[model samples]
Target: MSKIFHPVSEQEALAELPRLRQRLTAKARHAHQYRGTEGKSLMAQAKRALRWHQLFVSINRRACQ
Candidate 1:
């Protein structure tokens, strides 16, 4: 099966950003319709960044080992 691939480094982590933000914004807009507070959305973005960083770190570590 084919796996994830990115032509550029910044584009890699930003790949899901648009879709994730859309989904999150919709949910937040529907849930509370709050103004300027992006709790869930920000958390989602942070988690995505953390996961991507962890994945790269793991790949590098394994390659070194």
Candidate 2:
């Protein structure tokens, strides 16, 4: 048997957006909990959330392409 390599379309990527958002939201909350409310920890949590958001955007873009 052979595997197929198909291109991902923008519409296909858009279709996955809801699922991705749900996942990222939960992960953000989890990360926030792990970091807790503090000086440095809070800052780290914020940075993580931002990075997750960036990664999510990149994933969507790449999937679309």
Candidate 3:
């Protein structure tokens, strides 16, 4: 599937920050609540997603500023 790209204005980024933060927190919590091999795999994925969201949030904050 092809993805569409668009610019996000400062206002939009600022607005999205809170929701992103919430998702980041949830991901962190999920990453911690697991055990065994399957849990390890799932936690790895969650950590990766958390890192991506963190980078996005930081970039958004910088752009907004």
Candidate 4:
């Protein structure tokens, strides 16, 4: 089996950003709320939030180009 990677169009990427940002915000809130109380899950949520940040940068960079 193989996976295909398709870069989204600039307009599509721009449209998706707001949704991703909302997810990032939710993940950040989860991470913060569970901090200390749930170390493992908090770390996981934080990692996911970080990935969203990276994706935001990547998508924005591509859109700029």
Note the clash tally of each candidate: 0, 0, 0, 0
lDDT of 3 by residue, 2-65 (tens): 1222345557766876786677667656765665576667657766876776566566555545
Descending-TM-score candidate ranking: 4, 3, 2, 1
Cα lDDT over the full model 2: 0.57
Model 1 CA deviation exceeding 4 Å by range? 1-37
User: How would you encode candidate 2's per-residue C-alpha lDDT over 1-65 as one tens digit per residue?
Assistant: 01223344566656766776676566556664554355456556656766765566566556545
In candidate 2, where is summed lDDT lowest over 10 consecutive residues?
1-10
Off by over 4 Å in 2: 1-37
**Which prediction has more favorable lDDT, 1 or 4?**
4
Between candidates 1 and 3, the lDDT winner: 3
In order of appearance, the predictions have TM-scores of 0.41, 0.42, 0.46, 0.47
Tens-place lDDT digits, model 4, residues 14-63: 67768877776676666655647585666676668768766765765565
Highest TM-score model number: 4
Residue pairs that clash (backbone atoms under 3 angstroms), model 4: none
Report the error of model 1 at residue 20, Å: 21
Cα displacement (Å) at residue 39, model 3? 7.8
